[model samples]
Target chain A: MSSREIDRIDGSALPLRGDNIDTDRIIPARFLKAITFEGLGDHVFEDDRAAMADHPFSNPAYRQARIILTNANFVSGSSREHAPQALNRWGIHACVGESFSEIFRGNSLAIGLPCVTMSAADMGPLMDLVERAPDTSLTLSLSDRTVTVDGQRISIAVDAAVRDAFLAGTWDATGLLLDDFEVVRGVASRVPYIRGF
Target chain B: MGKTLLKKVWDLHTVRPLSTGQTQLFIGLHLIHEVTTPQAFDMLRARGIGVAFPERTFGTTDHIIPTLDQTRPFQDTLAEAMLSALERNCAEYNIPLWNLDSENQGIVHVIGPELGLTQPGMTIACGDSHTSTHGALGAVAFGIGTSQVRDVLASQSLAFEPLKVRRIAVNGTLGNGVFAKDVILEIIHRLGVQGGVGHAYEYGGTAVDAMSIEERLTMCNMSIAGGARVGYVNPDQTTFDYLRGRRFAPQGDAFDRAVSWWRSIASDADADYDDVVEIAAAEIEPRVTWGINPGQSVGVSERIPATGDAGTNGAVAEALDFMGLVGGAPIMGTRIDVAFVGSCTNSRLSDLREAARIAKGRRVASHVKALVVPGSRAVLAAAEREGLDQVFREAGFEWRGAGCSRCLAMNPDRLEGNQLCASSSNRNFKGRQGSPTGRTLLMSPAMVAAAALAGEVVDVRDAL
Candidate 1:
């Protein structure tokens, strides 16, 4: 019904603890002037590159990886869509965190970046595995909601609705609204003074 | 059963239920900006529909207008055309406009409250997401699309489904250094951005009650991003006082009557909620955005999360690959090249005052370039009267005129290639500050001030 396109990404397990990861840092605000999200992967941290020349992203260990896992309170300021656009553009499958900010998470999800939340306790083993093998590439099994790196399973919790959405591949809430519109309208009309509203 | 503010406002505004799964809801106020209005106005012309109620509609230019060099025939041709179209449309429709020359000119959200157009117990609509900013005045403001914009223009009524309501109350006293911005950042962090989808947030509690109207406005403004169709703080003494001397607020006996009516509409003490969240003020801090989004943040005292420490969303391997950041770095000492203080988010006099307090008697780092822009001509005048401009200029901040400078970089004010800036404006998404490689660090104005002085991500308290 709207011009905005939506996507549904399958669930994945990711673990990382970083604070102050902002929209500029996520995709860098400078990339917004561009007509498209294409090629944004290079500028994800245009601000950080000048600070740390040999950053891991500059290294070759991680490539073609999608999805970001972080601790509580991910994406905190500004309602810039480029952050999620960049991640989604650059093959980032999804973002999982203990908690997420309102605007960042919404904008991300609107454009198909699934922001999944898991408990801290459930994320410990996965985080521990990453710490021990810093360069290890891990895979998250969405069917069973398990994270595995080098054959070892990692514990992580995910909400059922989010998991189902990921598996079913639909991120549009409006569809949900429309599906229940008849019932919602019926109930709304019954309420005095609300039939018109 | 808990009824949301959307339900209450919708019920009050409904003239009739439509067969198209939409209720015919009445709109008390309609706000418009430049970018989205042109097509709607054209559509109105095509349908031969003049605005049904011109008095209820207000217009301003923000999205496409240049903040700097606001002279005629703007540098961007598209922007210039949009501006002219808005002016032409406003004139033809007899709609009141707050053009660049008008004292009320600024972001649509900024001007609504100043003009007293946004008020308690009203349903407002604007062709912008941040229309939620008006909800602070206790109005249920909805962000509509161009078609909806046209609908309001042609009919003065819109069809809409109902929504549930959530009551979010923050009790206790907010400590100094922490602000409404931080409080909101904390809320978004805890609840996630989509937590309020299909819900209206009714903010209350001792802490919210104690906030100045401006502070409360900040909290409600970002509710749209959090997926709230509407966010409102119940009208009280604070709301009434803020509107008392304004142009649109009622006067004398009428004021008294209005206040009584306003008070009656607040959620009663026993009002139920579909959901309620309580956050302590003491837990909040002078918030800043470190990642490319608003929610990826922590206290100034905290360090960057280690890759592994980032929960399932951390995707350390991937973020580190893209962001060029390693795990476990200290976010505090991160160097910055530029510092900006302005935007609809935090460009008011109070915001300037806080930044000035940190900048006074301290020189910015030699390599750092700092800019201070007010939200409006009035805010500019107030800051000048208070000598805040001198304080900033003396501290090496470029004291510029009022506009949405450096917020979205539509003007000359922007970051160079890959320049790291500590910015008070909202949104840090890459290139949001203009340069294809520019980086923005979102923070409170005070934090920007502190960072300007240190040329790094230093805490404002440290500067204090």
Candidate 2:
């Protein structure tokens, strides 16, 4: 475990159009049986890509897209860490949506796949821009809390502490917990239920 | 204004406020199962970190364990590997594992409460989404991802942003055949899956107060379905009574002290809530999901909603297409190929009893493969003691051992291609029960039994 930072992402976009695109759709339940998250990227949107030939992830223009643009409530089911791992492995650096599920956002941030949100009023146009021009590159600034696409700057909303962690390269929570080992042991010792083997 | 049970428990467990505006909260109980913990354990080994509190954690093999056979060296190599991994990890980490042979072994959510480990005012964490099921004991239990599983294993703490409390008050009398499953399905129907995303739903009111501990557990178990991170009912005499005489619960005067503390942690009558939504119990029906998501549900007698009538026209179209159903047609009498009466959601003794009552003297349709998996080994023992297993067996339903069989399907029990199932489990997402194209319809255990008997989705009220 080591400290990691995600300050900005400048890449093409893959626009997934829908509200409540669940984790099941991101990475289906069948793929969750693996011992580790390795090799999950190739199967991201496994069902949708196979079911629908024109799914955005499979669209040739967005082949190397590093950002996922979508509507409200993206990644909204089951707390499968594979959802983010799939995206990270598939080369997704950031996600811009109207909102994200709590567990999904946490999972994304933990793996350094920043999930940022823009107001709904601003999201529609931004999504249209990305979809209308797949070649359009977008830049997301964690410190500035904004996304710049085609010279247009759109304000994004992110939890301040979350953004701070991303900007300062201090978001590796596991590493932080490991660093505060003595304090963690102190807290564990205080818990009535905690006991050593 | 008074504090909510969520706040009371949360504040009590806060180790310190982190620079990230997240509270480093101590977790009292950590639950693990075969599927999710293997990677977390691997992470621990790779990092050379020991579990901070082994006793605070408990392990069980549910997801990958075979419910039909008890022999070692499972037929599925992957399943065997998962079980072996869990066994090795638990042994090396010094955590007590409730293996298949253990009396305490069952679904992670089910065993915790039965063993009296799920007490009031405690913060519980598990890798499975149904961890919210433990919230029925008045604890703030929510699911975490595998990475957080590693974090908790190493530190026994989580960096969490506190949630605003949302009071969902269901007042008035519930009509006949309307179980706790209906109440939660109705709530999800009204709120949509994303409605409770950033909040902790504190269920209260006359309807919830009248429920048994099992019923309350059923309600809180689906909190994840409503997109709430955590859901709980306040501790009352009902909760205390359930805990008394249990394995891990306090005994004698210590029990009395524990009860007092638990009572003190209940949300005050005037507790401040960020939002309050009221549901009239009389309005709720024996609900069943007709679409892929939990929110896309209708009353037992209601028609499959038209695309426009379903509110989200595009989503309804997609769901209807995926489910192979027509909009504006009656959902009742829709043919089902399978019926599953188990999951962390509704597989307790009471659930089995209800299903058995419906299954008595009736046989499962020849085309419908039905199964009844108990939530815990204790539940299985209790059901066997009452001859419920025999009743199910006689009715042509395969009575399986205790495990999460056919619910998310990590074991041999899974749906064949395009098989439609009536499931008592929480999620109805496409392929949630194993087969990529398999369809699942969410309903009560009794409803699932009814479907098995009738060969199609039918109203349990009429069957009764």
Best by TM-score: 2
- Residue runs of model 1 more than 4 Å from their true location after superposition: A1-197, B1-6, B314-323
TM-score of chain A of each: 0.69, 0.93
Displacement of residue B369 (Cα, Å) in model 2 is 1.3
Docking class of 2: medium
Q: Tell me the tens digit of each residue's lDDT in model 2 across B1-464.
A: 99999998887777788878888888899999887778898988888888888988999988877887779999887788888989999999899999988999999999999999999888999987788889898999979998899999988888888899999999999987789999999999999899999899899999999999999999999998898989999989999999999999888888888888888889988888999999999999898899889998999999998788734668888899999999999999899999999999999999999999999999999999999999999999999999999999999999999988898887889899989999999999877888888999999999999999999988988977
Each prediction's RMSD to truth = 8.2, 1.9
**Each prediction's DockQ against the real complex:** 0.09, 0.51
List TM-score per model, in order: 0.72, 0.97
